[model samples]
Target chain A: MRTKTLITSMGLFAMLCVVIFGLGVKGLALDETFRRFVLAALWVCTWFAAVVGLNRAAASDRNKSFFSALMLLPFDPALVYLVRLVSTLVWLVITQALLVLLAVPMLKFDFFSQPLMLAVALMADVGILALGVLLASATGRLRGGEALLTIALLPVTVPVFLAATGATEALHTGSGAAEAWPYVLLLGVCDAMFLALGLLLFGKLNEG
Target chain B: MKAKTSNAPLITLALAALGLIGAEVTLYLSYFYTPVQISAGTLYVVTPSSGSTINLYESYRIFFIHLPAAYATALCCTLAAVGGIAWLLTRKDAWQALIVSASEVGLATGAIVLLTGTFWADYAWGSGRIGSGWNWEPRLTTMLILWLAFAALLVLRRAMDTDKQRAMMTAVYGILLGPLYPLVSKAIEIGQTSHPKSFSDLLSAPEIATTKQVATIGILLALVSMVALRYCWNRLGQRMAQERAA
Candidate 1:
């Protein structure tokens, strides 16, 4: 059932992306600047959806999952949080891949040309997933949690978006790997920080 | 049994009075006593036709309050985060009060920072070719983020029904958000943008820095006073709820 839901969700998300970027915006025969702008808009939208979805996922786990209680019985609450974060990251990766697949055919971008950039984008998503899971879990059960989640999430992820965009832009221009790595490195650092923070605080947040 | 009355309101009233007085004194000193050039940094306005150096003169005086307010905001946020951790460990109302109060104060100060900053920017740059008066300079961006995070903390607090749950959740959020302040500072240093190294660069004279420090002390006292008042209010509310229950 979960798998079916996941597949259906991905299909709808892909269709939505195609509607927005593929056909909605003059069928992607846009100038270089406009194309990149559309790409960025899609990037933000993808992550935003991931955050919203993950928040629901985390909340449902807490309220509905039998394993949640079982998992908490073990001394290591961190393991449960790790599992949730990893699962969220996996879902994000799949959705991101689906988005890119739809985007590539419609937008006509050379994916293989910038393998390094693609890796950075994926890692950046991992960072977003870490943040999304932690924050979403932290606020998910509360009233007005969704709005609060977006408010807290967007500002914190500013650096992530900034770095990721810069790196991706560099890659698209076939700029040397040198220009791109700094941004990627920044993303990596942010991801590390988010992951560490999630591990340390997720249990505390979930307790009450 | 009748609940014992808290002296917090009385103390906060006194502190608030003193804070107001100190603020007035600081304003007087900034205007009359401190050197303009020393108090306000060197201001240069760039123009398309010809680049010109412009001194802000009396207009630069905003920094006296602005700088201290900004500092107080950061300090309050730190205190709130620390108080959050302490609250979690001790499971005490006092710590929760500390977190909630400091967060409120932080939000107020953050607003002041943005407000005064806009006016100061207007004086410095808005008058010139750069009419926008607002720039996404790294520091400004980070400060804006800090403000939003704290605001979110307040929203989170409102969402919870029980004090214990609210305290626990907010404390955790506070700690998680705390690192952003220093991290943003570091990121700004690495990814250079147009914010100055320090707002006090114009304070070349020792006397100016001294006056600024004095103003900071005044602002800090005001912040503490406000925090105390807020906590007392929280306590009173809790007591009222208890009384109703009884």
Candidate 2:
């Protein structure tokens, strides 16, 4: 089941990449710089999809064995949450790097021109995924969970979305990280704050 | 019982009407009675000069409506958040009703503010200068999302069959997501984008003394009227639901 979930998520990401690149090349006729922005957005979406997929799979497989496995794990639940958060961030960064490579040939400038953009994007993703996982946990236990999940999560993540869009724009304009770092920092602060809060609240909220 | 039950609705209607009258009077004074003034040391240029002349016109009228609606929405959001927290802590259905009422009113006022803001932005910023149409600036984007969130909460409430469960879940969302408004506003301000500052800072001396005061009064009255109406509607709905259950 886990393997199927992973494969389906990867397949969705691959299809998304193909469509985005095709549109960038054929439809929008976007320059390399703009293509990079689109690619970054796609990468973020891909990571988000994978995390969501994994969350849904875990939620559905709420059997005794699974709970036993979780109980037997050496790490604490908080530690597990941290590890998952870090792994998701790593996956997002890797996808972003891959996007940067694909975007390099079609662009007007090199990757080094917008180092801060990469950082901002990664931080924004971390914040989003952190909040997503938290809300997913809450909604996973509720009836009509998926719809409730979207409603609860989307508004909370608006700041991250705005920051990422702004940072991406700054990168394309070659405004440097100085202009965009504050937004990146804001996302980082929000991620850290919310992660801590979620960890503290998770036990109470998760109890049936 | 019917006579006694009807009194609450009557009182609510009377309060709403009085509040509406107050709002209208305030609007009249703001537009017709208030004197317009130029900025300090900034003279109006009749001829070509280095500085451009600023005019107070129809666009400024949006302020008469926008400020009050924005404040009202903020007030409603606060009330909703408080009510949600109260419901969570006390486990009271009355608090849940209050949360629902406030959420609905907040969503309505938010929509009004966004509409007025777009009109103001069109005239003030010049259409298409920022973006094609309704540029997704921070304030606008945040307000839009907040409005949608509240609307979704209301919808979720209606969809649920059991009142207790519905209220519980909705209250949780209302409390958790309520803070996003301030966060979004601060994030936008920090980002330094095309979102407009509230008119409190931009008014000239005469405009501030006359038009600003009137607008502020008008908005307060309107907000009171809307909230009263919504509160009454919520109470009525609760009563009806009780009757049905009985």
Best by lDDT: 1
Report the C-alpha lDDT of model 1 over B1-246, residue by residue, as the tens digit.
Answer: 333365658878899889878888788888787774522224322221223344666666787788888887888778877887786688776777677777888888888888787777666655543446665545666777778877878887787767666777778777766766675566446443444455444566565667687788786677667877888887777678778989
Question: lDDT per residue, candidate 2, B1-246, as tens digits?
Answer: 788667877876776777677778767866676555344234311111213333434456667778788778877777887887787678776687778878888888888988987766655553566564576656776888888878877866665545555666667667755666686457446554455443333454465456567666666666766776777777778788888999
Q: What are the models' TM-scores?
A: 0.84, 0.78
For TM-score, the strongest prediction is 1
Provide the overall lDDT of each model, using Cα atoms, as 2-decimal numbers: 0.71, 0.63
Q: Which stretches of candidate 1 lie over 4 Å from their true place?
A: A21-32, A59-75, A108-112, A142-144, A169-176, A179-182, B1-5, B34-58, B122-131, B190-192, B199-201, B205-207, B239-246
Report the TM-score of candidate 1, chain B only.
0.82
Per-residue CA lDDT of model 1 for A96-161, tens digit only, reads 777777777767645557779677878788777777777777567666677778877776676677
Error of 1 at B233 (Å): 2.5
Docking class of 2: acceptable
Clashing pairs in 1: B41-B202
Q: What interface RMSD does each of the candidate structures achieve?
A: 2.2, 3.1
